[model samples]
Target chain A: MSEQAGYVPVVGAVAEPQPAPEKSYRFSEQAIQELEEILTHYPDKKSAILPALWIAQREYDGYLPPQAIQEVADRLERPFVEVEGVATFYTMYNLRKRGRHHLEVCTCLTCAVMGAYEVVHHLEKRLGVKVGQTTSDGEFTLSEVECLNYCGAATVVQVGDKYFGNITKENVDELIETLRNSNEFTPADLANAIVRLHIPERTAKK
Target chain B: MAETLVLLKHRDVPGIENIDIYEQHGGYAGLKKALAMERDAVINEIKTSGLRGRGGAGFPAWIKWSGIPKDTKKPHYVLCNADEGEPGTFKDRELMLKLPHMVIEGMIIAAYATQSAKGYIYIRGEFVESARSIRRAIDQAYKKGYLGKSICGKEGFDFDLYIHMGAGSYECGEESALMSSLMGERGQPRLKFPHAPLPIHEGVWQSPTLINNVETYAAASQILAHGGAWYATMGTENSKGTKIISVSGHVKKPGNYEVELGYPVLDMIELAGGVTGGKLKAVIPGGSSVPIIPAELCKDFKLDYDAHQVVQYSMRTMRLPVVGSGGFMVFNDKTDIVVLMRRTAEFYTHESCGKCTPCREGTRWIFKILSRITTGGGLPGDIDLLVNICDQIDGRSYCGLGDAAAWPIMGAIKHFRHEFEYWIEHKRSPVGEDCLPPAPEPLNPLLTLTPV
Candidate 1:
C-alpha cells in the first residue's frame, strides 16, 4: 500500500479520447519553484509526476482535471495517453474537482480487516455524499483509497497534510468540522488540533 | 477435528485432507471435464464465471489468461503468484498445505484452456511446510495422470507444474517483480516501454505468459465442476463466489475462515471469537497496504466488494479478496498506531531496492523523520518535513510500493499526531494518561521510541 514508496509510472489500461494540448497554465512562481525543487530530488524526470500533479492540483484550485494531467504529460515528455493512464490508476491523482480540503481514508488490508469499510460508510453517510463525489458545498470530497500503510493500526486517515490514524466516525466528524470552519490553516495547526489536541511548537506558525 | 484445506471452501467431503481421500471424494472431476471440452469452451467458461482474482487486485482471471496470445510464435507459459507478503494476512499458507491438489487441478484446467504446456507455482519462502505439501501433491498428481502428459488418460496434452519458492520480499508480490524473482533476479519492478512494452507479453525469458494467483486457479476447479453461474451466485453482484479470510490478530481463533464475499466484518470477527481485547481501536480491512479503520467507524462495515471501496478515502492500492491468499489482520485498543507505522516504515525502507530516487531515498527519509520523532529526537518541523517528503514520495515512485511507504506515514501522522508531538515535546507516549491494558498499551509502530 502506502508504506512502500517505490518508483513506478501510474500504470493502467484506459481507453480515453486524447484532447488537443493547449498552452501551459502559469503556476504561481512559488508553486513552480516548489515543484521544480521537488523534481530536483528525483533522478529521473518522470519521477516528479505525482509531486508535480500535487502542486498543479493545489495551485489550480483543486483536482488535476484532464488537461492538467495532459500538461504535465507534455512537460515530462511522457506519452499523452500513457500519462493519462498513470494519472487515473492511483487514487491520489484526483481527476475530478474536490472541495477546498481533501480527506483520504485508508482501506488497505490492515484497515479493511480492522473495519475500514464501516469507516468509509460512516464518512459518506455523515458527508451526505458518496466517495469520489464532492460535497454539495464544495467544502469536501470523499475518496476511498487503499492502504495508507498502517497494518498494525487500522482505520487511519489523512486530512489536508495531517494523518489521523486510529480514527473513528466521531473523530472524522470533528475533523470535517475543523476543516469546514478553518481556511488558510497550516498542516501543523490542523494536525495538532484534530490529531494530538495540544502541540504548540508543531503548530507554532499558526 | 483437524484444520484442513477443505475448510477453505467448507466442503463436507470425507477424507479431503489425504490425497487418496480427496481422489475418492471426486476431486479431479473438473480436470476430467476439462479434458473432454474444447480449449475455447474452457476459456469461455472462465470468462462467463465472472471470477476476479482472489489476490488483492480483482482483475478478471479469464481475461488475463486470454491475453496469453495462444497462437504466438513462442510457447505460452502459466505462473502462479503464491507469494503472500501482505501484512496481517496468511490465508495462502493454509490452502497450500491443505489443498495443494486443488491448485494443481485448477492449473491443469487453466493450462488446457490457455494451452500452456508448462506451469510454475511461485510460493513464498516462509511457507516451508506448505511448499513441501504442495510438492508432494504435485508428485501425487503426476503419478495419477493429472500433471504429466496424457493427463487423465487423454493424449497429446502434456503439461508440467513446478513450485518456485521466493526469498521473502514484499515487492516480489508484484507480478513483474515476481516474474523477475522467478527468473532469479533482484525482484524489482520494471518499466513498461512503448513497442517492447507490457510485462505479461514478455515475462520470464520474454515469453507470452499467463500469470494467476493460486486461489484464482483453485476457483477454476469449481467453475469446471459446477459451472460459472454456480460460482457467480455465491458472492455479491460484482464480486462472485466465496473468499477465504485468514483472520489473525486480536481474535481468539486467529485462523483462516472461508466466507461468502458479501459477509459483514462483524460477523467474520464474531466467527473468530469476537474482541479478545476490549474497545476495538482499529481494523486493517484488507492487507497491510490498505489503510486502517478504527473500530467505531467499522460498526456497519460488511467484508464484501463494493462496500469498502478504498479510492473513496485516497487509498489507491488494490485489495484482492484473498484470491491469491486470503488474510485479514485486526487491531484493538492495546495496539499502538504510531509504533506500528514506524515498524512498517522500516520494512519498506529495508526492502526499498533503491531503484528510484524518490522511493529509494524517500523511504529512508520517512523512516529517519519518524525515527527522530518517535525517539524524542524530532525537531519541531520534522512532522511537516516528514509529511512534505511523503507528499513527494506518494505518486513519484516507479510503482505502488512507493505509495505504500508514504501513505502509512501520512495516515499515521494524521491520526496519531499527538504521539509524534509527545515524542518530541515529552519524549513519551500518549498512552501514559489513558487507561490502557493491564500495564501499558503496546507501542504504536509510528510512535515507538528507540531506547536511549
Candidate 2:
C-alpha cells in the first residue's frame, strides 16, 4: 500500500550534498542602496536580513543561490553560516534551482478539505511531474505549500507574485497556457490577464 | 445576525483604502480620541473593555500594555503580528489588504498606550499585495504626520512605525520566534521562563516590547473611539465585542465574516452560504490546530472564546483548551478524516523549527506513523503508537506550537478511530481510491514524465 500511492516519508533519506561555490558575489548598486534604506527602519543592520534575502533572490533569478547568500551576509556584516541558516529556515527562499514559473498550490486544511489535493493531482497529470519536481523543459516547478492566507478562495494557486483563488482544473490549464506563451510575464501581469478568473465574494462589510 | 460593524465597518467601502477616504469615514477618530485623553485614562478604558489578544494566545490586551513600566530607562517598542500563516486563517490578510489604515491606526494608538516610540508590523512574505498596500499606507501616514514626531500636533509625542517581512516561517508567528527572526536568526522561540523576562518587560533589542495581533490592535482603535463600555455591550460575559471569523472549506460561500461573540457557529456557516453538499461532517471552530468537533457536537457551538470551552466528544482523553485565532474551517461528508489528519501532521512536521527535540522528532514521527497507517503499513497497535507520541509532544515540548502539533492526532484518534482502523484493515485510505485521478488523464508526449 505504501508503494502503490507513491507516498514516501522524507525521514532517513540522505540529503543531497551542496557543492562549494565557484565564485564570490556582491549585491548590485541598486540593491545596496535599497538595503541601506531598509536598514534605517530597524535599530540594527541584522534586522534587514529578510528584506535583503528578498532583494538578493530577485537579483539572482527567483531562488537564493549560495553566492547570493554569501553576498547578503557580507553586505549585512553577518557570518556566512548565520545568513544561510536564516535562508534555509524560511520556505519562500528556495535554495535549489526553481523553474521559471513556480506554482505553489496551497494544500493546507482549508484548501485540502475544499479539494486542493485534486488540483495537485490535476497539475501532476497535466505536467507529468509530481509535487516538488520541475518540468523537464525548465518552465514550471510545482510544490504543495502551506496556507497563503486566502482561505476564502479555496484551492488558491500562486504563480510568480499574484494569487488566483477558486482554481479549477480548467483554470489550471488556462494558467499553464498563459505562462507557457507569455512574452512579458510576472504575477502582476498575469493578475490582469486572469482578473476575471477569481470570483470575489462578499466579506465583512457595513 | 447582529451586524456590528466596529472592526470591519469600512471593509467593503471602495475608496476606504485611501487615507483621505478612510479619514472621512471616522477611521482615525479612535487614534485622535485616544491621543486627546490622558495616557493612563486610555489604558484604563482598554482594561475596562475586556479585550483579549486574537493571536491564538488570547492573553488580555490591556494587561500586556499595563505591564510596560513607565520608568524603564530603555526605549519601549510595539510590534504587530501580521504574519497570518496559521492554517485555515486569513483574517489579518483581508484586514490589512482591504483596510490598511485601520490596522495602522490601531498600531499608533497601541504604541501610545504602551508608551512605545517605535513599532513594526511583521507581515509574511507571501502576502505581496498586502505588503504593497501597507507600504503605501505607511508612506501616506508619515506624510500626514500620523507617524513621525509631533503626531496630531501634540508636541513631544513622537512615534515611528516600520513594516518588516518574514521570508516564510510559520514558527515566526510565535512572539519570541518573531523577535529572533527580526534579529536575523533562525525563527525559533526562545526559552521564556527560567531564563529571561516576559517580552513586555524585556523584548526585542532588550527593550520592553508590546506585541499584539493585527485584529487586536484594530479592535483597540474602535474601542477608543466608541468608548470601552459601548464595545463591551456586545458578546458574552468575558468575551466582549465582535470577532472577524475567516470561514472556509466545504461551504457554499467561503469568506471572512464579522460576527459578534456568542453568535451560533451554525449561523455563521449559514451566513457563509451553508455547507457545500448539504451535510456538515465536522467543524474546526478555531484553526486547524484546534480539535475537530463533529457535526452533532456543534449544535450548541457559539462564536465566543468560552464557547470553545464546551469540550466536544474528542475531549474525553485529551482535554485541550481552545483559545483559537478564529480560523473556522468546515469539513463536509465527502471529506476523508484520516487524510486530513495526515496532512495536518505533515504541516506541523514541516514547520517544526528543529529547536527542541520533542517537537522536531515528535512531529515528524507522528507524520511518519500516519503516513504508514494511511498507506496500509500500519501495525495493529498503531493507534496506541499515535496516542503515546502525542502524549510526549503535547506538554513536554518547548512552545505552544508543539502542543498544537500534538492535539489534532489526539482529537482525530479519539473521535475518528474507525477511520484509522479502516485504513489499517483495508490497507488503503477509504477515500483515497475515489479521490485519485482516474488513469492519469492519458499524458501526451508534450507532458512526459521523468520521475525523480
Please tell me which predicted candidate would have the highest DockQ against the true structure.
Answer: 2
Q: Model 1 over residues B351-394: C-alpha lDDT tens digits?
A: 66566889989887877776666555778888778877876777
Residue-level lDDT of model 2, residues B124-191, one tens digit each, is 87887887678778878888889989899988778988777787789999999999888778899987
| lDDT (Cα, 0-100) at A157 in candidate 1 | 74
The segments of candidate 2 whose C-alpha lies over 4 angstroms from its true place after superposition are A1-23, A184-206, B308-318, B428-452
Docking class of 1: incorrect
Model 1: residue A85 alpha-carbon error in angstroms:
33
The alpha-carbon deviation from the true structure for residue B135 of candidate 1, after best TM-score superposition, in angstroms, is 0.9
Give the DockQ-based CAPRI class for model 2: acceptable
Clashes of 1: 95
lDDT, model 1: 0.64
Worst lDDT run of 10 residues, candidate 1 chain B, spans B433-442
In candidate 1, stretches whose alpha carbon ends up further than 4 angstroms from where it belongs are: A1-206, B1-7, B10-17, B193-196, B307-326, B417-425, B433-452
